[model samples]
Target: MIALLRGFLWLTGFWLAGESLVVLLDLPISAGVVGMLLLTIALLLRIGRLEDIAAASQPLIGLLAMLIMPGVVGVFFVADEFAGQWLAVAVALVGGTLASVLTTLLLMRRCMPAAPRTETPQETSS
Candidate 1:
Protein backbone atom coordinates (compact mmCIF):
# COMPACT_ATOMS: atom_id res chain seq x y z
CA MET A 1 0.00 0.00 0.00
CA ILE A 2 2.75 2.40 0.84
CA ALA A 3 4.57 1.47 -2.33
CA LEU A 4 1.44 2.03 -4.37
CA LEU A 5 0.92 5.47 -2.87
CA ARG A 6 4.51 6.40 -3.52
CA GLY A 7 4.24 5.29 -7.12
CA PHE A 8 1.04 7.28 -7.60
CA LEU A 9 2.60 10.39 -6.13
CA TRP A 10 5.73 9.96 -8.21
CA LEU A 11 3.72 9.55 -11.42
CA THR A 12 1.55 12.54 -10.46
CA GLY A 13 4.64 14.66 -9.92
CA PHE A 14 6.02 13.62 -13.32
CA TRP A 15 2.69 14.48 -15.00
CA LEU A 16 2.44 17.86 -13.31
CA ALA A 17 6.00 18.72 -14.23
CA GLY A 18 5.36 17.87 -17.87
CA GLU A 19 2.11 19.83 -17.95
CA SER A 20 3.80 22.81 -16.35
CA LEU A 21 6.58 22.69 -18.92
CA VAL A 22 4.07 22.49 -21.76
CA VAL A 23 2.14 25.47 -20.37
CA LEU A 24 5.29 27.47 -19.94
CA LEU A 25 6.59 26.64 -23.41
CA ASP A 26 3.13 26.85 -25.00
CA LEU A 27 3.88 23.63 -26.92
CA PRO A 28 1.08 22.10 -29.02
CA ILE A 29 1.82 18.54 -27.85
CA SER A 30 -0.38 16.80 -25.31
CA ALA A 31 0.64 16.91 -21.63
CA GLY A 32 0.05 13.16 -21.31
CA VAL A 33 2.60 12.44 -24.06
CA VAL A 34 5.08 14.74 -22.44
CA GLY A 35 4.55 13.05 -19.08
CA MET A 36 5.08 9.61 -20.62
CA LEU A 37 8.31 10.79 -22.30
CA LEU A 38 9.49 12.25 -19.02
CA LEU A 39 8.75 8.99 -17.23
CA THR A 40 10.60 7.01 -19.91
CA ILE A 41 13.64 9.28 -19.55
CA ALA A 42 13.54 9.01 -15.77
CA LEU A 43 13.38 5.23 -15.98
CA LEU A 44 16.28 5.14 -18.46
CA LEU A 45 18.33 7.38 -16.16
CA ARG A 46 17.48 5.21 -13.11
CA ILE A 47 15.94 8.23 -11.46
CA GLY A 48 12.77 6.14 -11.09
CA ARG A 49 13.36 2.52 -10.15
CA LEU A 50 10.90 -0.03 -11.57
CA GLU A 51 10.64 -2.05 -8.33
CA ASP A 52 9.60 1.05 -6.42
CA ILE A 53 6.66 1.64 -8.77
CA ALA A 54 5.78 -1.95 -9.71
CA ALA A 55 2.65 -2.21 -7.53
CA ALA A 56 1.09 0.99 -8.85
CA SER A 57 2.42 0.40 -12.36
CA GLN A 58 0.67 -2.94 -12.64
CA PRO A 59 -2.75 -1.62 -11.63
CA LEU A 60 -2.36 1.60 -13.61
CA ILE A 61 -1.38 -0.34 -16.77
CA GLY A 62 -4.34 -2.66 -16.29
CA LEU A 63 -6.64 0.36 -15.83
CA LEU A 64 -5.32 1.88 -19.05
CA ALA A 65 -6.66 -1.15 -20.96
CA MET A 66 -10.13 -0.29 -19.68
CA LEU A 67 -9.68 3.34 -20.74
CA ILE A 68 -9.55 2.25 -24.43
CA MET A 69 -13.29 1.57 -24.29
CA PRO A 70 -14.01 5.32 -24.02
CA GLY A 71 -12.00 5.85 -27.20
CA VAL A 72 -14.09 3.21 -28.99
CA VAL A 73 -17.26 4.91 -27.74
CA GLY A 74 -16.00 8.28 -28.99
CA VAL A 75 -15.34 6.73 -32.39
CA PHE A 76 -18.94 5.51 -32.49
CA PHE A 77 -20.15 9.00 -31.61
CA VAL A 78 -18.12 10.42 -34.48
CA ALA A 79 -19.07 7.64 -36.88
CA ASP A 80 -20.57 10.01 -39.43
CA GLU A 81 -17.45 12.13 -39.66
CA PHE A 82 -15.30 9.01 -39.80
CA ALA A 83 -17.42 7.53 -42.58
CA GLY A 84 -16.98 10.71 -44.60
CA GLN A 85 -13.20 10.46 -44.20
CA TRP A 86 -13.00 6.67 -44.06
CA LEU A 87 -10.16 6.26 -46.55
CA ALA A 88 -8.02 8.91 -44.94
CA VAL A 89 -8.73 7.50 -41.49
CA ALA A 90 -7.88 3.98 -42.62
CA VAL A 91 -4.61 5.12 -44.18
CA ALA A 92 -3.68 7.11 -41.08
CA LEU A 93 -4.50 4.23 -38.74
CA VAL A 94 -2.52 1.70 -40.79
CA GLY A 95 0.42 4.07 -41.21
CA GLY A 96 0.46 5.07 -37.57
CA THR A 97 0.25 1.45 -36.39
CA LEU A 98 3.06 0.38 -38.71
CA ALA A 99 5.22 3.30 -37.63
CA SER A 100 4.60 2.63 -33.97
CA VAL A 101 5.35 -1.09 -34.31
CA LEU A 102 8.53 -0.42 -36.29
CA THR A 103 9.67 2.22 -33.82
CA THR A 104 9.06 -0.07 -30.85
CA LEU A 105 10.85 -2.97 -32.52
CA LEU A 106 13.81 -0.76 -33.42
CA LEU A 107 14.09 0.63 -29.92
CA MET A 108 13.89 -2.83 -28.35
CA ARG A 109 16.48 -4.22 -30.71
CA ARG A 110 18.81 -1.32 -29.98
CA CYS A 111 18.41 -1.60 -26.21
CA MET A 112 18.74 -5.39 -25.98
CA PRO A 113 22.12 -7.02 -26.49
CA ALA A 114 22.47 -9.66 -29.18
CA ALA A 115 22.27 -13.28 -27.99
CA PRO A 116 25.38 -15.47 -28.28
CA ARG A 117 25.32 -17.52 -31.50
CA THR A 118 25.62 -21.25 -31.31
CA GLU A 119 27.21 -23.29 -34.10
CA THR A 120 24.78 -25.70 -35.83
CA PRO A 121 25.54 -29.43 -36.39
CA GLN A 122 26.08 -28.75 -40.14
CA GLU A 123 28.66 -26.08 -39.42
CA THR A 124 30.44 -28.35 -36.93
CA SER A 125 30.49 -31.20 -39.50
CA SER A 126 31.78 -28.85 -42.22
Candidate 2:
Protein backbone atom coordinates (compact mmCIF):
# COMPACT_ATOMS: atom_id res chain seq x y z
CA MET A 1 0.00 0.00 0.00
CA ILE A 2 2.79 2.40 0.79
CA ALA A 3 4.48 1.61 -2.51
CA LEU A 4 1.22 2.17 -4.33
CA LEU A 5 0.81 5.56 -2.67
CA ARG A 6 4.35 6.54 -3.63
CA GLY A 7 3.75 5.42 -7.18
CA PHE A 8 0.52 7.39 -7.39
CA LEU A 9 2.34 10.45 -6.11
CA TRP A 10 4.96 10.14 -8.84
CA LEU A 11 2.29 9.70 -11.49
CA THR A 12 0.23 12.64 -10.20
CA GLY A 13 3.27 14.90 -10.00
CA PHE A 14 4.12 14.22 -13.67
CA TRP A 15 0.50 14.73 -14.68
CA LEU A 16 0.39 18.10 -12.92
CA ALA A 17 3.66 19.08 -14.52
CA GLY A 18 2.31 18.12 -17.93
CA GLU A 19 -0.88 20.09 -17.36
CA SER A 20 1.13 23.12 -16.39
CA LEU A 21 3.24 22.85 -19.56
CA VAL A 22 0.16 22.61 -21.78
CA VAL A 23 -1.49 25.61 -20.11
CA LEU A 24 1.69 27.68 -20.27
CA LEU A 25 2.62 26.78 -23.86
CA ASP A 26 -0.91 26.49 -25.22
CA LEU A 27 -0.10 23.00 -26.57
CA PRO A 28 -2.88 21.39 -28.55
CA ILE A 29 -2.17 17.89 -27.25
CA SER A 30 -3.87 16.30 -24.27
CA ALA A 31 -2.28 16.85 -20.86
CA GLY A 32 -2.24 13.11 -20.13
CA VAL A 33 -0.22 12.50 -23.32
CA VAL A 34 2.20 15.24 -22.32
CA GLY A 35 2.45 13.75 -18.86
CA MET A 36 3.23 10.29 -20.28
CA LEU A 37 5.88 11.72 -22.60
CA LEU A 38 7.51 13.50 -19.64
CA LEU A 39 7.41 10.31 -17.63
CA THR A 40 9.04 8.37 -20.48
CA ILE A 41 11.82 10.95 -20.73
CA ALA A 42 12.38 10.92 -16.98
CA LEU A 43 12.61 7.13 -17.01
CA LEU A 44 15.05 7.18 -19.88
CA LEU A 45 17.15 9.76 -18.04
CA ARG A 46 17.21 7.59 -14.87
CA ILE A 47 15.56 10.35 -12.86
CA GLY A 48 13.43 7.63 -11.25
CA ARG A 49 13.25 3.83 -11.27
CA LEU A 50 10.32 2.06 -12.90
CA GLU A 51 9.72 0.06 -9.72
CA ASP A 52 8.81 3.25 -7.94
CA ILE A 53 5.69 3.68 -10.09
CA ALA A 54 5.03 0.13 -11.35
CA ALA A 55 2.72 -0.64 -8.46
CA ALA A 56 0.35 2.19 -9.30
CA SER A 57 0.66 1.81 -13.06
CA GLN A 58 0.05 -1.94 -13.18
CA PRO A 59 -3.43 -1.63 -11.71
CA LEU A 60 -4.33 1.19 -14.09
CA ILE A 61 -3.02 -0.82 -17.01
CA GLY A 62 -5.26 -3.68 -16.04
CA LEU A 63 -8.22 -1.33 -15.95
CA LEU A 64 -7.47 0.05 -19.44
CA ALA A 65 -10.33 -1.77 -21.13
CA MET A 66 -12.79 -0.72 -18.45
CA LEU A 67 -11.56 2.86 -18.60
CA ILE A 68 -12.16 2.97 -22.35
CA MET A 69 -15.69 1.61 -21.92
CA PRO A 70 -17.14 5.01 -21.07
CA GLY A 71 -15.91 6.54 -24.31
CA VAL A 72 -17.25 3.62 -26.36
CA VAL A 73 -20.61 3.91 -24.62
CA GLY A 74 -20.67 7.70 -24.99
CA VAL A 75 -20.30 7.30 -28.75
CA PHE A 76 -23.54 5.35 -28.76
CA PHE A 77 -25.33 8.37 -27.34
CA VAL A 78 -24.00 10.49 -30.20
CA ALA A 79 -24.52 7.86 -32.87
CA ASP A 80 -26.52 10.20 -35.08
CA GLU A 81 -23.50 12.47 -35.43
CA PHE A 82 -21.63 9.56 -37.07
CA ALA A 83 -24.46 8.32 -39.27
CA GLY A 84 -22.90 9.39 -42.58
CA GLN A 85 -19.29 9.29 -41.39
CA TRP A 86 -19.23 5.55 -40.70
CA LEU A 87 -17.00 4.82 -43.70
CA ALA A 88 -14.53 7.51 -42.77
CA VAL A 89 -14.54 6.38 -39.15
CA ALA A 90 -13.99 2.77 -40.17
CA VAL A 91 -11.12 3.73 -42.47
CA ALA A 92 -9.54 5.86 -39.74
CA LEU A 93 -9.86 3.10 -37.16
CA VAL A 94 -8.41 0.43 -39.46
CA GLY A 95 -5.62 2.72 -40.65
CA GLY A 96 -4.73 3.76 -37.14
CA THR A 97 -4.64 0.14 -35.93
CA LEU A 98 -2.47 -0.93 -38.86
CA ALA A 99 -0.12 1.99 -38.30
CA SER A 100 0.19 1.23 -34.63
CA VAL A 101 0.90 -2.44 -35.30
CA LEU A 102 3.45 -1.62 -37.98
CA THR A 103 5.19 0.88 -35.71
CA THR A 104 5.35 -1.62 -32.86
CA LEU A 105 6.76 -4.28 -35.15
CA LEU A 106 9.39 -1.89 -36.53
CA LEU A 107 10.42 -0.71 -33.07
CA MET A 108 10.61 -4.24 -31.74
CA ARG A 109 12.74 -5.31 -34.69
CA ARG A 110 15.10 -2.40 -34.11
CA CYS A 111 15.37 -2.80 -30.35
CA MET A 112 15.44 -6.58 -29.98
CA PRO A 113 18.67 -8.47 -30.47
CA ALA A 114 18.97 -10.82 -33.43
CA ALA A 115 18.45 -14.52 -32.79
CA PRO A 116 21.50 -16.79 -33.10
CA ARG A 117 21.62 -19.11 -36.09
CA THR A 118 21.21 -22.79 -35.28
CA GLU A 119 22.88 -25.56 -37.31
CA THR A 120 20.75 -28.47 -38.56
CA PRO A 121 21.98 -32.07 -38.03
CA GLN A 122 22.68 -32.45 -41.78
CA GLU A 123 24.82 -29.31 -41.88
CA THR A 124 26.67 -30.33 -38.72
CA SER A 125 27.38 -33.83 -40.08
CA SER A 126 28.67 -32.38 -43.43
Winner by TM-score: 2
Instruction: Please report the TM-score between candidate 2 and the true structure.
Output: 0.68
Model 2 residue 41 CA deviation (Å) reads: 1.7
TM-score of each: 0.63, 0.68
Which segments of candidate 2 are over 4 A away from where they belong? 91-126
- Best candidate (score: lDDT): 2
lDDT of 2: 0.90
What local lDDT score does residue 105 receive in model 2, on the 0 to 100 scale? Answer: 100
As a whole number from 0 to 100, the lDDT of residue 68 in candidate 1 is 86
Distance from true location, Cα of 74 in model 2, Å: 1.8
Candidate 2 C-alpha lDDT tens digits along 22-125: 99999998889999999999999988668968999999899999999988888768779768989899999999999999999999999988755663445767
Model 1 misplaced regions, further than 4 Å: 87-126
lDDT tens digits by residue: candidate 1, 1-126: 888888888888888988998999999988888998998999889997677677777898999878788777776687776577888889899999999999999999999877556635457664
> What range of 10 consecutive residues in model 1 has the weakest lDDT sum?
115-124
